[model samples]
Target: MIIIFIASLILFAFLYMVSRNKYDEFIEPLDEKEFKIKKIMPIGFWVMDKINYRYASKYDRNLLNKTAELNGGVYAHYYLRVHWANKITFELMLLMFLLFINGAMGKTDMELIIFSLLVMAVVAYALDKDLENKVSKRRLSMQIDFPDFLNTLTLLINAGMTVSGAWTRIVTDTKKSTPLYSELRNVMLEISNGKSEIGAYEEFAKRCRLPEVTKFVAVITQNLKKGNSELVDILKYQSKECWELRKHAAKRLGEEASSKALFPMMLMFFAVVLVVVTPAIAGLIGSV
Candidate 1:
């Protein structure tokens, strides 16, 4: 027992040392060139590149470039992979500890361990799904509110402000009300920090990942490039379209909700009838 305890302690110490080393490695600062090198040097990047090359060969390379640009270039991919790998490694260690505890307790049932793993897998899957749903709902709310935001921009533009100027105004006006407002504020800062207006807009669109925002960006980008004067009118039209779509969506949702209530409503009605009729039938039988 003493030997086992010592061995366990030594194993834990080794894990702690390894973890400390990895943590230090992760936290080490890199110069911009080194950052770029590490970003491109990961095994994951080559795999992703090959996959993207094969799958999206037909699409405009510009789209991929745009995505990478918004992500702060290819190095962001390396950071993401490193983070994911660390998480996996941590989870593996946890599983190993659980197994080790079971072994130390002389509980060597493979079936129990398998069942525990399956339960953990299910729990993790459920948590992931819940998180995904929450994110989707938040994104949908942002999309729903975006047209009002666009109209505000149109108003600002019509009042003689440039596009970037309008964004700055919107950021100031709406920063307290919504996450989208906060995001726009950050974009304005990026613009102020030497990023071009188009680049900022592109980043915003990519972050939002809504088709409406993408279309709006594309239109606004072209208009800006051509020095078009009718941008306010275009924005107004888009805003109106967004409102109409929202109204239609609300109507459809109302109809579906009513449909869902129908079955439960009928069940309740039938239950009430049975309650009323049952007493009457029992009294009739008693009288007979």
Candidate 2:
């Protein structure tokens, strides 16, 4: 076990040294704040680039690209590859650490091997789960912010502003930089850069990838096409509906928070019970 650990450690060091300079281009642009795995990214890139096997399937690629697009903007494709590489690289590092620990402890049981493998699997699953959670949080943020944007846009349009002008006003005047607002800013940017309004809105919907945003974009595009006279009324109705949805989302979040707290509360209750009863039981035992 010790020999294996030493050899593996040497090999990893060699790989890291050889690949660090080779993959600096890919690793340098990754922001540590946005990417938790940025530190291991050079070795990760090497693993992805040098490993001959196809680690990601077509379905995996599509799912990753979609998820990355939501989080990574224009660099979605690059990020998808980086994420996969980082996952595998991190798993390999963990496995090496386990090997070293086993060597040092002189415990080479089959159970330990199985446990190490399970840990690797758990880490892999956890990384993917974290990414999904980020996407979910982003969607929730956009959902929460959507109602205010709709109300503002409706007001501006009712006061005789064109939809484009109203959208620009709301986006420009807002100080909040939420996901919905950022996407709103993107749409205006595209339009200002010569994209058609309908096209820009469609792209915005794609980037957002939310049903609520999709419905809102559909209404706007329809208005642009057919010139809906009751656009303000329609927007007002949607805004009210979105506010209701936001309330429901908030309630659900509160319930989730309470449930999450329940386990700790249970533990504390048992601890207090033990503290209060243990001395009394000890006295009774002494008397007996």
Candidate 3:
């Protein structure tokens, strides 16, 4: 009893000491050689990684890469290292939690271990979901900003600027720190570094990896290389299409907002009904 508390305390103290020494060092697998799977990781990591990689086939690499890119992860391996490191931390933390729970509550070893693993599984799943949510947020930002970008480009191009010039102008003038504008800024830098207009546009499309953006880039590239004629009309068509997509996105957002509000709305309704009925029910009970 008292002895168990002492043991748990010592175990958690040792965990803190281990975390202080190992936490930052484990997360810095960012050097060039870190990707090469040789001597950079901890000693026993190879065994754990061997077990982890067996399940790696279950996840989508392209989706993971895109999510990583959205979060400024240049290489997929950087995120992988962070994920595994965090997972290990969770494992240790949950093990300690189970130990403490067992010591404090007199739970059996099997019961505590099973409960801990179940909780750890849920938390681990939540970590993957967090990445998916990040990707969705970036996509939403890009969708919301794309329409304004198209309108601005059309306006500048119609105002006697070449496509490349209009693009650079928009990149410089816009103050919105969205993913779309950030990518545009990158494109602007690429152009400034002597990259051709077509190449920059192509890279932007690839980085964005959106259907609408890819289509728009293809339009720009085609018009830039071939003779530019009726470009304003083409841009106007794109602007119209962009506005339609924007409206659709807004409607979807509204629907999602309404759906989220339903739970709170139901709670409020139940509260109001209870307020009206509670006194009546109490009076009836007293009479009976």
Candidate 4:
């Protein structure tokens, strides 16, 4: 028990220092073949990349893209993100193995089985939660970028480019580095590979899975099917619509912020009340 407690403290302290200094993030990218894990546990992680490559290569391209996003599209490129995920899973499994063995040393068979299963369950949940968080953050960033995206598209359309032309122009010319832009770049790749404009837009809208993006896709598809004479007007309207949504979102955020402030405000109010009432109560007690 003491050993476990001491080990936990050391682990926590190391984690704190690593997080504060961002030690893991300091490592520069290396070729997968050349990548070597020179660390405490050599059991799982050293060959993780090769294993990840073999497994990742088996996934369909779309699934691979999603895996990349969940692993970490914001901080690292897709390949690097996959590599990171592989490494993380490997290290976690190795740690869990060591901890499980330590825990099972004096335990009966049933107890050991239950404890190992519980640890595995908790580790699985944590990994899923981390992936979900990363994916949500990516989508949130795309949602936030929508209004600006609309404005750019509207500008290009009003300047007399075809919707497809405007999309290509924006994808090529825009300097902003966001998930939306990254997705649009992929859309351009599809278009350049002989996919129809509508098909590419549909793919983009589907992948984004946001109502705002879906609405924009619907408008673009309708314009494409019915001839694009109203393209500029449609884009102008979308720009306005996106901006209105942004306003509503901002208002909700403010309300949430106000609600969060109430707890602190209540604490301060009670502290003031205690300060004012304490002396009177003391006087009464002294007189009694």
Give the best candidate by TM-score: 2
Error of 3 at 254 (Å): 1.1
Model with the higher lDDT, candidate 2 or 3: 2
User: Local error of candidate 3 at 198, Å?
Assistant: 2.4
- 2 or 4, which is superior by lDDT? 2
Q: Could you list the CA RMSD of all candidates, in the order they appear?
A: 10.2, 1.9, 5.9, 8.4
Q: Which regions of candidate 2 are displaced past 4 Å?
A: 52-59
Candidate 4's clash total is 0
Query: Worst 10-residue stretch by lDDT in candidate 1?
Result: 37-46
CA shift at 64, candidate 1, in angstroms?
Answer: 13
lDDT, candidate 4, at 169 = 86
Candidate 2 local Cα displacement, residue 22, angstroms: 2.2
| Candidate lDDT values, in order | 0.63, 0.84, 0.72, 0.67
Arranged by lDDT, best first: 2, 3, 4, 1
> Model 2: per-residue lDDT, tens digit, 26-46?
888877887776766677778
The TM-score between candidate 1 and the true structure equals 0.59
Worst 10 contiguous positions by lDDT, candidate 4: 38-47
- True lDDT of residue 5, candidate 4: 40
Q: List, residue by residue over 146-209, the lDDT tens digit for candidate 4.
A: 8987898889888888888888888788877788888888888988999999998987887787
- Candidate 3, 283: how far from true, in Å? 2.2
TM-score of each: 0.59, 0.93, 0.78, 0.56
> Which is the leading candidate under lDDT?
2
